[model samples]
Target: MSLEPKKSILNLEAYKPNFGASNLKKIIRLSANENALGYSPRIDKELKIGGFNRYPPQHSEELIKTISKIKNLDQNKIILGNGSDDLITVIAQTFLKPGDEAIYTEYGFLQFPQSITVAGGIKKIAKDINFHASVDNILKLITDKTRLIFLANANNPTGTFISKSEVYRLINNIPENVLLVYDAAYAEYIRNDKYTDGSELVEKYNNVIMLRTFSKLHGLAGLRLGWGYGNSKLINYLMAVRGPFSVNSMAIEAGIIAMKDIDFQNHCFDFNLKSMKHMEIELEQLDIKFINSSTNFILINLLDKDKFSAKNAVLFFKNNGVLVREMNVYNLPSHIRVSLGTEEENKYFLKLLKKFIRKNDS
Candidate 1:
């Protein structure tokens, strides 16, 4: 007989990425909430010189030091990874044991369940209130077997977020042994006043960790760079389990340049601010139902489930050479997520969307 894989591995479905057309040059990409302004010019300047022979620095020292300054956290609290997903895997390996449970909200990141399953842990889904993570619902599902919780601050698919006060309440109530993984992948794009990204809680409590990524605002998705901030003990444990030299030397150099390029950072921030407001105003004028997003995207609710479903909207945008995310996989059949692009791209998306609405809806 052939060798059989573990049952946990067998049961897992391969992650389906966006439509293949997403990669084509013809389409205007608004599906992946990427930085529309693109990467900093400084990255190119740094990468022209070579460092291909040696392995990356063991701990990503210089990059972490820069992040420490911006975050006002100790370097000991930081753990760098190939990407935030790598850290998620490390947490699963470090904390989740066979038959133990991990909690995620109903519409949490797809990666959470995959990470849990790969680690041989039982996954529990806590129902959300409307589209936002309901802390109360999450708390109710916490049995003694629960070892971890993953909350997406400035959540994806649905661009809603909970306030810092609410996050504090959740932390105060969670059992001390259970760890909270705050997936703040979109934290940099948030312009709200009340959001925390869970850093304050991570500082005060040993059980909370804040995970951030360079993929979004820093325009370093190609580099696959991300980092986490938590108690020194927890950070040390993750570092112990993580692979050596996961963050390559090239990525390390690019990350340092991107972090220090304050001009580019400000440019991205200003563009997003202008575009998000524009999206809200235009969507309302067209009578489109959309979540007021705190991040770089908006979730348009196509209330006419049968006539103008999310699938239909996807096809419509795809036909027009614009790429937006379909939400059926997220159990949101009537909603589509659109990332804020540059001014011209945003206007084109609005134009095509308005035309689609008039053609189908009217």
Candidate 2:
């Protein structure tokens, strides 16, 4: 007889990540939303010093201290993860039980639902308005069985986020029994005055967990390093379930250096602001509709969905040696998502975008 897994496990589809081919140097990759500027140069010094033979520090203490200092969070309440996805899994496993429900927005990160299902919890999706997470809609979906709520601030694919007031409303209304998972992977890229990663909320409420990653602005994606801040009790439970040394020494070292490299961080922040504004102007000139993004990526819609669809745009870009994310997986068939690359890369992508539009003019 065949070995059988749980029904939920059997029903789950494998996650298809956008890891570019080995010939990545020849391709302009805007599919994964990774930082194009790369990690802080200070990491090279640490890598040369060497510490590969020994096991990583227990709970990554030094790394935690560095993160705590930067975030102004308590060291005891912080936990490092292999990546933000790792912490998401930890949250799901620690808080959810069989037959419990977890809520996420319709266009939120795909990991939220996958993590919930792996923990044998029901996935409940709340509708979004204009590709933005609707606070009212999410609240309406909540029930006594709802064990967790995953909200991706400056959410992926759509690159749209709710205001601080909206986030406050959601938190104030949510029951104390339901844990809030605020995924802030792209938080560093946002410069909006009205935005918060919900870190302050984590300090105020035992039910909140704020997740951040070194993968985006820090450009340490290859290291797969991330950290979460929450109440001491919640963090202790998450750490209990996490494997000792899930975070490697190299990642920890890289994260520490990256966190301290304020100059590089500021450079990337400035570049993104300038490049995004330039792209926005170009898009407006070409009559291409796109989200007013606060994150490092933009979601562009092709109004002629029937003829010049998102799939066609993806193919056209690929043929031109540029790669953009096709949004069909996110149920955005009319839209394509592209990450802001360096200035030259942005110009090249914009040039090809114009060429594609001209070709499709009918």
- Model 1: per-residue lDDT, tens digit, 1-362? 88878778986888775644544568888988888889999888766457689777889789899999877878889999999989999999999989999999888888899999999999999998888999999999999999999998988868788999999999999999999999999887776779988788987999999999999999988889999999999988998999988888888888888888989988898888888998999888877788888888899998742478888888889888898988887788889989998889999999998888888856
Go through the candidates in order and give each one's C-alpha lDDT. Answer: 0.88, 0.88
Per-model TM values vs. the true structure: 0.96, 0.96
lDDT of 2 at 237: 90
Give model 2's TM-score versus the native structure: 0.96
Clashes by residue pair, model 1: none
List CA RMSD, all candidates.
1.6, 1.6
